[model samples]
Target chain A: MRKGIPNDPGRRDRLRAVALEFIAERGLRRFTVRGVAERAGVSPGSITYYFTDTDELIMSAFELLTEHAEPNFNVRLRAAGTRDEAIEVLIDYVIDPDDASQQEVRAVRELYSLGSRDPKAAALVRDRLEANARTALMLHFTEPCAHALDALIEGLWTQRSWNDEPLDPGMVRTAIHGLVTAFDSLEGTSA
Target chain B: MRKGIPNDPGRRDRLRAVALEFIAERGLRRFTVRGVAERAGVSPGSITYYFTDTDELIMSAFELLTEHAEPNFNVRLRAAGTRDEAIEVLIDYVIDPDDASQQEVRAVRELYSLGSRDPKAAALVRDRLEANARTALMLHFTEPCAHALDALIEGLWTQRSWNDEPLDPGMVRTAIHGLVTAFDSLEGTSA
Candidate 1:
């Protein structure tokens, strides 16, 4: 195992980390093995050996990004003692990510646009969405509610990323609270 | 006015129209002045003559694309006689964009990602969002609902673009209805 190159866990992680950093600093149009290798203190040959090509490298970095995000979500969910608290957690997760994580949103979006054109990357993003929906399902959401909330979350970030309007404070919480309470009443009637 | 080269109205419109077509077929990375000019049967200098550079051309293409979408939204809004019909219109607008417009979605997304990096492009998108929100306000939605719906629309597209799970037929309608009904009840209580 040549450290930070091949057959080493640390090398793989480092490569992924640096790849994301480069994407964050620059857009995906310029993501290059040589650029990452130069920044990461690894040889370009090593990055190729491990990643094969730019698509592989982009996918792997994205995988690392999603993996990094899963724990925060788990923590947010665990912190919710009630359904409303859980809704708050979900909204914040979508719109109010920490500074470092905020950067990831832009990076991931670039990857997503890439995915729309590239099936391999699309598969990676799609797998994550499925797993996330399943996780929401496990948390007692009805199927439609699960999909709606997921899409709503996606929409909030999508708006924030490209929109000019400053999202009002408490807006999401109001919308989400309204959504869950409606469903709660529906559950009441059905039950 | 040198027909296809500057000081001419037709030249600008033609350039914007062709730029969008190329973005849909090839995405933004390969969207170039040369390519667009070649496709339009004009010299590259003509493109530069009409638009200052690539960023200006891209931002202009985005402007033309959004302008094209606004009328459909207005028509959809006008067609809906009831709140439910309006909600349905909103859902369809987000998810079931038609063939030419489907390309616009991809094209807009690329422009959006481009906005995050380029201030000039970002300014263009932001201006459109402000105008859109203003129009929604004139339609009489409360502030929260308007932003939430916008975000939901954005989220639906985001999920469709990246999520692995296929969206259910009525999933968006259900979610939008749920949120709207919740707020309606809230309004009922307050009134």
Candidate 2:
């Protein structure tokens, strides 16, 4: 079992933060206790003291990544009064270059890469995505539509990252409007 | 410039195949000349002879991954007679477990992880995605809709992968239907 510190939650948090930075800057395969320790200005023993297993540390870092993202999404989403506004908010979140920093993008890619091979990690990613869909449901989207919207949002975010040139905002908005219109049409249907 | 093995194209192809398998099984971060050497049953020096730089070897492996995926997609896509059928083909490509082997999924995830850091790699991934969109255009989808559909297909495929439980085929089909119907509505629009 991994041991937990009775105090110094801040230190544990710092270690996890540094670990995520390590993952963001370097690939996950290169992660090591010593690497994180050096960055955190702590000894290797100090890191092991909080989390006995490296997997546990890595997972903790992933959780931190999620925790950082959710609140920001929630704040903007909760502020929207109507479904259309919410949809626009989601689009803005995806297409706005400032919304997800490069560090966050890198961390997400690393975690998703880990998820590709590890079911437990996959579940963590799924939970976040499903949570986004669930929020969409609250905004009047049907279940399937909500899920599709969630997928579209993530896909757009990823696609934007890959393009060397900037995405034309007008085209992106139009494309998403088309999708959301489709989902709206299905609102009264069985789907 | 990287040296070309003009005399033994077969040997060069074998090296790329082995490198891709190594990437699929392990990961890019863990890829090393010695590691690929043992797996390929060749000496590390011989591996370097083919790929003077490790980055060159990794990129070639990625190209091989794309080559394997594109033909399967192209054949099915070309066979679709209408836009609706093309969409179905795409959805099947995503939902069908048999379509993409687990190895392919792992390798793609690893490459996308690399793309998160490397602009050149990002371009490669973007090229494959844009190619899919272009095929959608040939099937009569509008430019914006084609790009949107491409993003949706990729998003759904990724979403399905994250789910540990089997996705209900009916729900998956319905979700895609809703999105496509919207794209179709915009068929003649300037978008």
Best by TM-score: 2
Which lDDT tens digits does candidate 1 get at residues B1-191? 44543387777899999998887677776778999999999999978888889878877888887777556766777667776677777777766656665576677777777777888767766677545644653364655677777777776766766644445656666677776776566567779
- What tens digits encode model 2's per-residue C-alpha lDDT throughout B111-168? 8888877777777787874575566446656566666766776677777777756556
| Model 1, runs deviating above 4 Å | A1-6, A78-82, A162-166, A185-191, B1-6, B78-84, B162-166, B186-191
Q: In model 2, which runs have C-alpha deviations exceeding 4 angstroms?
A: A1-7, A132-139, B1-7, B132-139, B187-191
Q: How many backbone clashes does candidate 1 have?
A: 2
Q: What TM-score does the predicted chain A of each candidate obtain versus native chain A?
A: 0.82, 0.88
> Cα lDDT of all candidates, in order?
0.72, 0.74
Looking at model 2 chain A, report the run of 10 residues with the lowest lDDT sum: A182-191
The digit string of per-residue lDDT tens for model 1 on A48-152 reads: 878879878878888887777556766667666776677767877766656676687778767777776888767767777445644753374666666667667
Give model 1's docking category.
medium
